[model samples]
Target chain A: MLYRARDLISITSFGEAYHNKPYLDRGDAESTAEPVCSTACDGASKTQARNRYPLRLERLIGRITELSGPAALEASCGLLREVQRRRGVPFVWILAHRLPPFAPDLAANGIDPQSIPFVFAPQPVAAAQAAERCLRSRAFELVLLDLTNQATGTNRGGGDRAAAAQRIDDAALGRLLRLCRQERAALLALTDRHGDLAGSLVFTRFAAARRKGSGRSGARERGGSDSCESGESSADYEYRVTLAKSKTGRPGAVYREVLRGPHGML
Target chain B: MAHTACCNLFEFALQVLLRRVPDWEAHPCVALAHDTPQARVLGCNAAAAELGVQPGMRYAAVLEFAPQVYAAGVSQAELHQHQQRVIAGLYALTDEVLCKPGDPGVLWANAAGFALLQGSPRAWAQQLSMRIERLGFRSRIVLGFTRFGSYLVSAAAQTPAVELLQSVEDERRKVAEVPLHAVVTSRQSRRRLARLGIRTAGALVQLPRSELRSRFGADVELVHRQALGECELPAQHAAVPVQPVASRRPPQPLISSEQILLETQLLLEALVQCLPRGECIAALTLQLSLDDRGQRRERIVPANPTEQVAVLLRLLRLRLERAVIDQPVSALRIEAELCRAAVQQHQLFRETVPERSGKQAVEAFAALRASLGEEAVRYVQLVPHHLPERRVQWRQGAGSQELSPRGSVQAQYADCPGTAQMVRRAFISPQPLARHLLRSGKLIGPYLLSCDWWQSPSRRLYYYYVMSPASDESTSALWVYYDLDRRRWMLQGTV
Candidate 1:
């Protein structure tokens, strides 16, 4: 949403009352001009009510699992920048292969690509080791694991089609998940599709649709048809995120955002 | 009175030998000639002297005089190098220094005006003695009005002490107290003076000039005149400038990192020996040649200037671990840039926070960067923009500007009233959700936000403060925005 200068709230003028509190009490609502929620719902309605304010349902802190889609990487970077800005938490992105071609998208959103620390480990074992080292060092507040290529492989039966997919290494995934839990730092794991989310034991899985292995193929087909009809590049494809696992919040929460520019999502 | 200072580094040959083998000082040892047909002791320690084993004595004769004496030969080149180091150490005290090449044990400097800057002559003498001792030598300094007078006094004084003569009369009286054997150059001249009842400088000066000249010849007459302060014995001031650089090349190539470190340590010790007093190393450049015809160079600049070899070695070790050495090292060279001693200033009123040593801090930072990548250490900066998301930025390195809690808010907004405070919990991406009923009353806004009309027409958004039905205290409020063009509800942030 494009916000005009006058419409924006001066976070500084808002004072210590709202900082780090996360929620506004009913008393706070009377003192400020911000709108207040009157009726407090119980149990089943709480889930429905949380869906009304989707941002509140998605916990930005602690360990979070992001089901990868067309714009998943871009979204992760955007989230990192936002968290750093509002909370002053620093993050390190661990890439399993070469840096992504769409890294310039970070710069478009006011983040310097050179200033974002990235540990490139092409091998799954190395990537896990790097993540462990970074966590133990306690130098970074957030660890972004890019498992796009690391989690997918060709089918073991030597199929003629190179696109056949296999599950990622379970042992490495287990170790990484354990390290994340032990370190207790906020971890965001980005994958190519929701079907490739079998390895992690700690993630509370979430998918846009409650379908099996075919769910990813269906989404891809839909995205392909939409882009072809509109004559738009694959980069413009839309992404629908599903929380598969969350250590602190509810699972199965779906979020949708449009992939815009080279590296960010709106 | 004009002041002259003479520094006598007693048993200089022994001192130089002891610097290399310190334990030898306890034995009745001497540096002797091993290759000559008739082996001779070149220098002897106090223990050997007690047994009548002196320099120029044959090695056989020395052993016969003192059966337990230890003897070894030291090359003239080695002695000269050590003497040069001692001279370099002295340069830090004064510019005017005199040393006879043939007798490096004795040095004379013009100390006439130094007393005003260095306090009393006795204190200056003691300070100079300490400087010499730092260079691995023991010395005695004597201050007097005449060069010969000061030399005589220093030669007679005990080792590691300073003696100052207040005036020429005092110097004369001190010189007269010295025995004829100590001042005379030859044994024959000393025996002749002793036989003539001239056992001391005072008795020698009491003789008739013609009789003394006739009996003792021109050399004795000159010595008598010098001792009595009648002759002008000019001390040729030989001021050797301090060496600016020192290098060491091992005889064999080093194949192991440990070997290289050992060699580098020896070279550093040699270089430090040449450093002027109160000076330290500021920067160092280490160059290594590999067996594969390739070279590597690394430069290390300590955050705080220091001459401690341990600190420098620690940094070098860290750099070397990261260096990709394709082949064995053929040679290594280290060049140091010297700077004045560092002085750290601390705020008196402020409470002191416990801090890690500079070396430790640098090491920790390097380890962090290696594991997490270069951009891991960063600071936040404010950027000018209308969007709250674009109004702040993170840059590498700890910024000089303090991000005070109040300052952070002030920097974010210009018209901020400095009263209300708010914290933003942002989502990596705004989440789209299905329409759901809210237990809380109506939403806060329809606050219209539109910008960038020239580039794209889909720039309109309607933001609202929606209260979640969840009873959980953490996720109770959310800032949601609706895209007018897309007609979809998106979650922007949590408050």
Candidate 2:
């Protein structure tokens, strides 16, 4: 089922923010909890550890494969490359970076990465925005959108604030919400931590016990960080990661889990 | 054997009178015997035969047959016009009509498919006779599988029996007593057969096949079948042509070209509406008679028959522009012969893209040709000669020439003058420009094209060059050439 923040409009932004992140990372977090990640990290060689990434990624790939269905995947070059390293299943990934609005050229950017095995499909504009538009147009199954700060138009030069805000255009987000309501396929929009889309279904990071130390103390000492000064603790962050939204069904509902570990996200 | 002949001579003459007088009802006499060639009474009935007036008797002779008879000559033209009207009226019943609009009116319509619609065959025949009578003409309908059989039955008609033949055997039985004229054969052949005691159709039919073949050619056997009233000719459906719809001409004399064209336009609109739909006439003959005298004028306009009334009118106007009318026309009659439909010949090549509209191009050519005479519209013609002027001759309009390609012939023309005489260029130049300019600014003079003096009295070197305007770089350069001996530049061609 489709999940979008627009569907859960009545859910208080701060109230639902705690559960949204984990909901987005359900698939990744699930696979990382599998036996392969833990055992491969403990006893296996570096080669074995590297190889186990696929085994963990296989589960993630299986989930993506389920979501892909009949309509093929439309993903960016970056997301496709990461998926390829993890799963080993070939897919079309176009380098569609920038495109004019409503131009039919977006259609040309669609590539089947499964064809010409292992060759990443690159183009002048990475087709992430195009892929999101394709999902809105219902041209494909599960589309992967990297809605990082830069893609959200926050990376534009600070001098022209109004122009930069206009460039952000938020129309793409609105279309994504509508697509999540209508499309049978899943829409997995990935955003890094500290992204401004707190109200949107955000994927949160839950480090494994081994490498959890890399940023665990920082989370504990976050009283100084804005997140803590705002009274948002690690538990509060976890709460925001789990809640999901759907148009027809009840909002802030739990759908599935996604696990990520040393190998990669499930 | 010839049947003993019987004709009512006086009755025939009297029937002629009743048709002529406009106010014969107001006349005092019980009957008016109007005649010059012969005489008979105007108002006579079936009982008048008791007074002894037979149809074939003369005016004075009819007095001997019947004492009250008088006489006057027949009005031939009026009688003929009446017959033509009767024939035209037959178009309502059937398209197939045969009319002999002369004396003793005969109209034959083959009703082959009418039997099913009109009940029995005899009923249809009776209905046909009643219909003819309503049209003011008495017709004896004798229908059969063949024309000869039907004609013989019509000749034999007495009081118009509705059912002339009952069965095939009955027809064969009557054939024995039929006269010699009933069979379609030469008189000499009939006599030869009669000498052998084969007097009747049945008698000939009974002869041995081998003996009959040896005595006469195969045609004799075919005739014997026809005489027996057995069908030899295929049943033919009659065709009655529709009466042409007429239009009123203008009040003033058609002196100017435009006035005549306008009158033609009005008439063509009426004519095209009168023609049957989906049928187009190829040639329409327009006959115009002068008012002053009976001096006749005629113009034949050939056109694409399937064109609309507007297109056809324009074509007629074009034709009239070409014709020189000698006298002022009093009456104009337009009669068109339906042109045969054009059948599209299937081409082998599949159409891959849009093509030039040939019909539009042809129409444009026709319009230009109408404004100009044969001399104005010229085509390039090629002759068998080495001389440049003689080798290429220009003809006007359509000409017979084989349009094909042979690469070897082009090479041969370039090699020798003798072989060049046989290699003919296209008779028409689609593009009439003179020359091709080399990349260099200087003009290479026209290629030497001179004829062999002994074969033909023609020699000239033709030069072709492109002339660019000195002042303007954007304007197109004109292709022109000069004849060396003529010492003048001529516009030879352009595309």
Candidate 3:
């Protein structure tokens, strides 16, 4: 069934709208349908689906992935390092009024700054439109948006403080999400620790906050030679990446990582 | 046979430049090859011509003579964009169109079918004129049976806004009467041909064809052939849009949605099999026949154009799943709009260097630039500069460059013993900092960065430290600098 016909039938059993009216599928019906039947399935299988979401991050294609925190750049880059390794995926970084992050730092990380393209959309509406055009092309696999700091436009004291949050309106967001899913392209938006991008449509939502009492500089742990060697690495700060909300994976789970460099993020 | 309508816009580049300012006639104006003063002039208005400014003179030299001259560069790309808009609008007016390749402003539309569909050719030509005028172009529309005939009539400077040719003889007579100074005629060629006692097109056409090329040039010969009706419209280039529509009337009504999907698959497969190589269906329109003989139409546009039946069928299935099927579907018609979906060169197995050859990606960047200005899209370019801001330059991206970096990228901690190196934000322009913010914590460094002493000298004393926040446990890393020349504290950037 395309929609949750059973739930609608059960909820309004007494009403004519339920029995007499023809069934029309809701857009988000499939996502909501799982919880009702979750009790019937084994916990292990449910966990498998939950844990599989992050494990498949490198190979998995689309969805709105939100990562915000002090070390969000590093965390998001760590995930992207694998995707770029696939070689030909086009990547674009979008900026809103503010200058992009330090390029040498981005080069220090595995990411080649020259390889990525940047879009300078000063206003919220323009940024969203630019992003929409990029996504609609169905060519870009990974699009990173800098919705971190408050954009300081021509006006001094403040610009639109909610510029980042209001970047993509609800209607635009809905369209972007659909385009992402259709293209199987990931739209990873990186925000600061105080970002207002904690929306429900986020396929994977998490944050990496720097733990207090920084760890001492220590020898590095290598998953392989794939780690960025150009960056002078030091285990100075430990970040606790907490999953606040995840439509694909289990929420509320915490993972710890020893960040190399303050944030040698992609 | 489709009757051709030729619309000519003379001095298109100059007119496009004039469109920018309303009272352009008040001043001497000229369009250049580029916006720079050194760029050569492309076209000029009457006032500029009166001031001794010619098409090939440098804009700076023109300014030397006429100091109050106004100038702007109408780039070929921009002109082509406007031409595309006109072509697209003409497509809306009529199906078949052949835009003159080099001459972006000149368009030939097949108005044969449209005369009946749109009531009359005069009204349609008026609409066409209004449409081009709205875009700030003065177009002369001439309707005739042949492309060369209509074009010749339209190119004549003294022709009316819209003229309808009654017959082929009338068109030839008008073409013969066209002066040597018609907008389409090359100025130098006109001068040379006039010296040979050929002041009109008829006099030029009377010359022997064997010696036409030897006497004049190949261009004149080509024009002579066109006038003689020897040259026809390039058949291969004539893009007559053919919409593929498939209709299926079932023996019985389909109650199950699955049945409809199964039928849709068959129809899509048939269409895909017939699709030409390198072409994909851009969009699909599904017309569901109701039991009462009414139609419910649903249109679907995929993220990317595809010829694959499965991808299109999946979208249709999704639509059908959500559709309100109040009555059984008795019949169906599927119309597909096709578009070119060719991908550029791809790497089969080589991953040696990062490359972006995706045609769609190129289109993506183009779409961005078309909506936003040229500076809207940018690419990061690393440069060897002492100042942090100068180290990286954000330049406009052409969307066709290689991603491989051959330049040396600076690494602060090239070989540090620490496993983690901190990241810092570099501001394009430093923000002013207060003395109180630095008082809360000990500064890490007085890193001396002074350079360009030979030029407009710049000296800076930089420091790095962590500042404790008043509200939270999260500490903020600050990078402040002291301008030795100004003797003031400024926040360079932050971590």
The best candidate in terms of DockQ:
3
True contacts kept of each: 0.00, 0.00, 0.43
lDDT of 3 at B212: 74
Interface RMSD of 2: 34.9
Candidate 1 achieves a global lDDT of 0.56
What order do you get sorting by DockQ, best first? 3, 1, 2
Q: Chain A TM-score for model 3, please?
A: 0.65
**DockQ of candidate 1 relative to the true structure:** 0.03
- lDDT string for model 2 (B1-495, tens) is 111111111222234455555344233222333444354434343544556654444556656555553345543433434444555555554446554322324456546565545676666666666765675445566555445555555655555444446555555566556665445356667787888887666677777666665677676777666665464443323244445545454566556567666776677778878765434565555666555665443333332335356665665676576577766666566766553344331234745532222232234333334433223223333355543334444444331111112234333322321110000111122123223333323343444555555654433444332233242211111223454555544433210
TM-score of 1: 0.37
Q: Who is ahead in lDDT, 1 or 3?
A: 3
lDDT string, candidate 3, B1-495, tens digits? 328888787667787788767588678899887889899888888888999988878988987879888888887655654665676667778877787766666788888778777678888888778878776688889888887788778878564498888888898898899886652246777788888888888887887899878877787888788778898533223343344788898898988879988988888888787775556786788899999887888776554567878767766765676567888999988998766654532224735432334656656665555445446677778899887888988776553544433333323223332233345666767777777767766576677899998998889887765665442445446767789999998876666
- The candidates' DockQ values read 0.03, 0.00, 0.17
Q: Estimate each model's TM-score.
A: 0.37, 0.26, 0.44
Ranking by lDDT: 3, 1, 2
DockQ of 2: 0.00
